[model samples]
Target chain A: MLAFVLRRLVQSLLVMFFVALLAFSMFRFLGDPIAQMVGQDTSLQERERLRVELGLNDPVPVQFARYVAGVLKGEFGISYRIGRPVDELIAERLPATLELSFVAALFALLAGIPMGVYTGLYPDRWLSKVLLSLSLMGIALPTFLIGILLILIFGVNLGLLPTFGRGEVVHIGFWSTGFLTISGLKSLIMPAITLGMFQLALIMRLVRSEMLEVLRTDFIKFARARGLSNRAVYFGHALKNTLVPVITITGLQIGSIIAFAIITESVFQWPGMGLLFIQAIQFVDIPVMSTYLILIAFFFVVINLTVDLLYYAVDPRLRVHGGAGGK
Target chain B: MNGMENNVAAPVADTAPALLEVRSLRVEFPTRRGTLVAVDDVSFSLRAGEILGVVGESGAGKSMTGTAIIGLLEPPGRIAGGEILLEGRRIDNLDYERMRRIRGKEIGAIFQDPLTSLNPLYTVGRQLVETIRTHLTMTEAQARRHALDMLKEVGIPAAEERIDHYPHQFSGGMRQRVVIALALCAGPKLVIADEPTTALDVSIQAQIITLLKRLCRDHGTAVMLVTHDMGVIAEAADRVAVMYAGRLVEIGPAQAVIRDAHHPYTRGLMGSIPTIGRDVERLEQIDGSMPRLDAIPPGCAFNPRCRQRFGRCEREKPSLIGQGDRAVACWLHEQGEGAS
Candidate 1:
């Protein structure tokens, strides 16, 4: 078990290294931070000294090692556009993005799984057919369009909810949460729904197909024959098998949720990292843009590691020794 | 030898009422083209502790009949016209809850492939314990202990250590034994074993068959053994029913059926089992494949393939006709023994 975890940790480190290398190398060519930070009247010699101070002229490998060391110590330098430490800038917006993504992910799973199981168990039912048709729309329509439609319905026509922004956030230590206040939650509804809709539909479809596939397996039929109640046969035996594939998919979907939150954030004007990253792109803020890249890659690596561990937990076939597979 | 004929046939039927009985059972599958009859007018009875082997080629409806008896028939195929009774009570029309209650408690099933039959995600012990708890009112500890006992009963070595292992950890034969253990853990009165040994290595087949026979016999569990292997019928079956294209062609004492098959189809089946001493260039086989369900000839479904098919054989289907406990579904036996 320890060895398995160690192996995953080593792989995660390797993935982080490659992503850091890519981010550092790719973001440098987008003009220069010195040009963005300094005033127009600054002397050429002053600019050169600043460049040397920032180690811009250092060898690529040495700079990378220094960048790696700095990242390991939670330092992301100063954003070229804001002239504030990039870590501090991200920390301000991190809560909003994390809150939105987690809520969206939870909505996708809690609602999607039951819908998938229901549709799978009774593919011929009227309700299942209706859900399936509606899900098709969910998948077909673009995320931004869904957000616009939601805004139109609730904000413009019905006028029941706030249209944009994280309305009223409550500060809790390092975190700022919308969940603690009604106005904040009400404002969050449209964007969260818009962001979650596609994932919910995808997860529902994936789970439904997987449930169908698992139901056809011999063990499920054997489970039925063994007189395990319909509940046990369907959920206990069939659903668990379906979840193996579902877990891998849901993990990837969560990563995409955070990555794609840029569209939702821009649509709602939610003050999150996605919105910051977009601004960073416009102004060529290398530190902030690169930090976002490294952060997203880190999320993927961590999620994938968790997914592998979940596989070991859910499936006994993957357990090589007697240690980790607790009876 | 003519001396083999005995009126006291069907093993234990004379001593006790049938544990499981099928009266004119018919299974059908509806397609866009038509309703296809999979098992047509199949009727048989099994006495407690006796083994009744239903042998046939692939697509002969032997497995279908077994699945129907256990109320686990695949969708779009159902028992369109039939009455399956266990201990003189009709079970075919029971609701899902009632049927589920009966499934592992009174009637258990073992399928062809053991590798696929057991859930890969669960420990064999967990599978066994769950089935036991489902049918039997046992506490968790009691069920676990019962499961261990069952594993040992099915001949798994070191039940304690191996019970925690998953299905993939076991060999094919060992997996089948675990499957058998799962089936019989509830002490079901009847077991429907559908080609239980067909997927195992040849050397392992005999061992599984022997274990299944001894365990069921010791438990007084009547078994409907469905297989295409004639040698298996001869070895383990007390009585045998030979089916061709969804209908029973001959049924009698296994020895009698193997040695003196009255139906030409059964005779061909016996002849096809290659004998060691015979120097024939080719083995005997039916002349044609089974007619497709949609296009089955109007009379005997096997008539086109039967070498002894006559004018009457092609005009009308024959029901099981018998003397004492023996029966044959063929035109030759429609009248008396010598009518043909």
Candidate 2:
């Protein structure tokens, strides 16, 4: 087991490296950051000097190598326009985005799972029908619209909660621990709910349908024949088999949540990596933008790898196969 | 000996009452065509320590009969008419909760596929413990002990250690044994094994049969064994009931049916069996398939495929006849024309 875990870790490193390399090159080649940086009134010599200083004149391989080395060393170069360290910009904004995404995921699972399980267990029943109708509405309505509506009702109209900005600051001694504490939590709720509604709607439906299919399997029938209680037949046996597909969808949705965050965070003005990304793009801050892109890519790869490993834990059969986590 | 048949059959009816009595049992399914009578007025009784094999091809309603006994048939199919009496107590009208309570307690069932008869997620021990607890009202530790003992009794190798393993860890035969163990865990008086050995390899199939026979004998559990394999019936069954078109065409002692088949369908079935010693061109095949129950033949359903079929055979539906000891359903015997 230790060897298996070690092998997976090694594989993860290789995967992360390739992912970082591809994201970096694509951001560099597809759009010309230098032109965006130089702007309207720049002399040719000045621009050339700027380009050579940034190693833009170097070969693609050399450029990539330097970028990777710099990233590892925590010196992500100065933003071309903002002139701030790219790392600082990212560090400032990442919390908000993560805060939103994590809350959304939590809401999705907590709300969606029971809703899905109920729907699957009792198809067309009143409670299931109500949940289905609610999910359908959730799917149709956009996340940004939901966010706006929430702000209007809770923040603007009722004045119960703060609408736009992060909540009032509370002083704490430690930055690392402080971020996970009360003040941070208070600031995160609105944005998290905003981003979470749509995901909850989508994931609930997937889990319900997959669970319905797994319930009809012969194994479930056997469980029933074994004189297992209704609870055991439905939840213990049926639900366990359905988790594999659910985990896959969750992995895919994490990537989508990141994409959705770009829009949701922008709408809510929550300072997260997504907002940093848009700022980097608009100002053509190449170092900041590239770093943001690679970071998102790294998260995607990491989330999927974690999901694959969880599959092995959930299903004993997959533990024997070498590619359980990889697959 | 032939002239003194009355004396030979006189003592057959003085035996003990049947262990299971399925009286006028009717199972129906609501299909697109209409209400299809899957098992039409089927009635039979099983004796303790006897294997009663029900033989029929697909759509002959053999499986539905088994499912009906266990109350496991899903919706759109229901017991339209009948009384199911186990140990002479009526059980057909019991609600789902009550029926489930009686299911693993009084009666146990093994399905066609062994893979389906065991949940793949749980360990063998867990499943056995679950059933044993449900029926026996034992404590957790007691249940675990019983489950381990059952696994051993089922012939699973290293039952104490291997019971911790999941269903996929065992072979098909082993899985069937686990199923048997579960069925017999509550020490039910009756066991319904529906094609228990069909999923196994040929050699493994024999082993399972031998094991089942030995176990059932030891426990004195009456068994209603449903299968299409005549060989299995000949080898393991004490009595045989041959069904065609949702009706029992003939039922008698296993030896009687194998040696002296009364119904044309039974004769055709026996002739169709491929024997090792005898070489014949194209084993005797029944001329036609079973008729759709919705539009059953005007008179006898099997008359279309029967070679002994006569004018009266197509005009009248034959019912089971004869005294308690001996029974036959045919026009030839009714007229005393085919009587020996």
Candidate 3:
């Protein structure tokens, strides 16, 4: 297990390195950062002085090495557009994004699993059919549209919740979160639901189908034959069996949820990394944009690694194989 | 030559109360086309401590009958009309909750494919212990001890150590033994074993059969042993019922069923068994496959395949006619047909 984790850690680092390399090269090709910094009216000597300060005159290899060295020291350069340290800017926005993603994931799991299990257990029932169609709509509609619909219903028509922005953020040392206040929480609801809708639908459908398949397995029949209560057979045997696939999809969907949050965050105007990403894109803030790309890539790698480890924990077959591989 | 027959044919009085009884049980699968009667008018009784072997080809409704008996039939297939009685109390119409209570406590089921029968996620000991606790009101410690004893009873080596192991850790035969132990753990009055040895190797098949027979005997549990193997029926069963196309063709004492079968289907089944001393061009083959549920013939289901099929065999279905302790569902057994 230790060896397996170590191997995954090494792989994660290599993946991050490649992601950094790709993002750096791509940003370099997308136009000069110096042009964006000084603007069209800036004099030539001023531009050269700015380039020298930013070490742009150095060769590509030397620049990349410096960037890698700086990254290793937790320095991600500076956002030319905002004139702020890239890491500090991202750090300020990370918590809101984390908060929104966390709530969305929590909502998806809490609502999706039970709904999926219900629909699976009673596939023929009218309620399940309704839920199935509703979930289909949830998956079919785009995130921004869902976000607009949610704001239209709850924010505009009902007047029950706040429409946009993180209302009030509470700071604890370097970290900040919006869940500490009622208005902030209410503001979070619309964006979270919009962001999580697709994930909820995906999870529900995955779980429902996987559950339908698992419930038909011989072990479940054997479980029922053993005189286990319907609850035990469904929850204990069938549900546990369904988790491997469900968890795999859920893990993959986390990356997607973060990706979709970009749109959802824009739709609600929630102040998060997604909003930062958009602004960074408009102004050609290469350092900020690259950092965001690398950070999200890092998140994907780490999430996938965690999912693999979780698979080892949940499935004995995988554990045995993992053990053999370690040997 | 027939010494083993004597041991199995210990006659019981006709009046002995049956542990499990199915009366005119009909299981149907309703489809868009029409309802397919998977099990049609099947009636049988299992007495206490009796091993009743139900033998047939695949799709003979042998497994269907067993599943119906245990109230574990999959959806769309249900008991359209029937009365299942356990010790004279009707249980077929009971709700799922009540039926569940009676299942592990009164009747146990062992299915084919032992690998699929045991949950892979849990330890074998946990599975055994949970089943024990579900029916019996045993404490956790007591259940654990009982589970350990069951593992040992099923011939699992190192029961104490191996109990923690998952289903995949055991070989196929050993897994079946665990399934057997799980089925019999609560000491239910009756066990329904559906093709228990069909998934096992030929060499390992006999061992499992013997273990099942011996364990049930020790517990005085009546067994409805459903299988397609005639050899298993011959060796393990006290009584044998031959079924074809969702109906029982013949049922009698095992010795008589094997040696003096009245139904042509049963006789054909007996003849198909290759004997070491006898040599022939090829083993006897039943002429045709068992009919699909939708296409079962109007008269006797076996008429198309039977060499002895007569004019009446195609005109009318034959009901089981009792002759002493045995019954045969064929026109040949009718009073005017032949008494010789």
Q: Which ranges of candidate 2 are over 4 A from the true structure?
A: A1-11, A28-52, A57-61, A168-190, A320-327, B1-15, B276-282, B335-340
Model 3: per-residue Cα lDDT over A212-285, one tens digit each: 99988999989999999888899999999999988889999898788667898899898899999998887778
- Runs of candidate 1 with Cα error greater than 4 angstroms are A28-66, A321-327, B1-15, B276-282, B338-340
Candidate scoring better on DockQ of 2 and 3:
3
Question: Candidate 1 has which clashing residue pairs, if any?
Answer: none
- Report the C-alpha lDDT of model 1 over A130-236, residue by residue, as the tens digit: 99998999899999999999999999999998989999999999899999999999987888899999999999999999999999999898999899999999988
Comparing 1 and 2 by lDDT, which wins? 1
Docking class of 2: acceptable
In model 3, state the lDDT of residue A304. 95
lDDT (C-alpha) at residue B206 in model 3 = 94
In Å, residue A37's CA in model 3 sits off its true spot by 2.2
The TM-scores of all predictions, comma-separated, are: 0.93, 0.90, 0.95
CA RMSD of all predictions: 4.5, 5.1, 4.6
Q: Pick the candidate with the highest TM-score.
A: 3
**Which runs of model 3 end up more than 4 angstroms from their true locations?**
A57-59, A321-327, B1-13, B336-340
Q: What tens-digit string does per-residue lDDT give for candidate 2 at B301-330?
A: 888888888998898777655544445567
lDDT of 2 at A119: 93
Highest DockQ against the true fold, candidate: 3
lDDT of 1 by residue, B1-340 (tens): 1122222123233857888878778899999888988998888889888899999989988999999998988989999886899999999999889999999899999989998998888888889999999999999999999999999999998889999988888888999999999889999999999999999889999999999999988999988999999989988999999887788777888997787888888888888999889899999877778777778897777888777778987878777777566888787886657424
TM-score of 2: 0.90
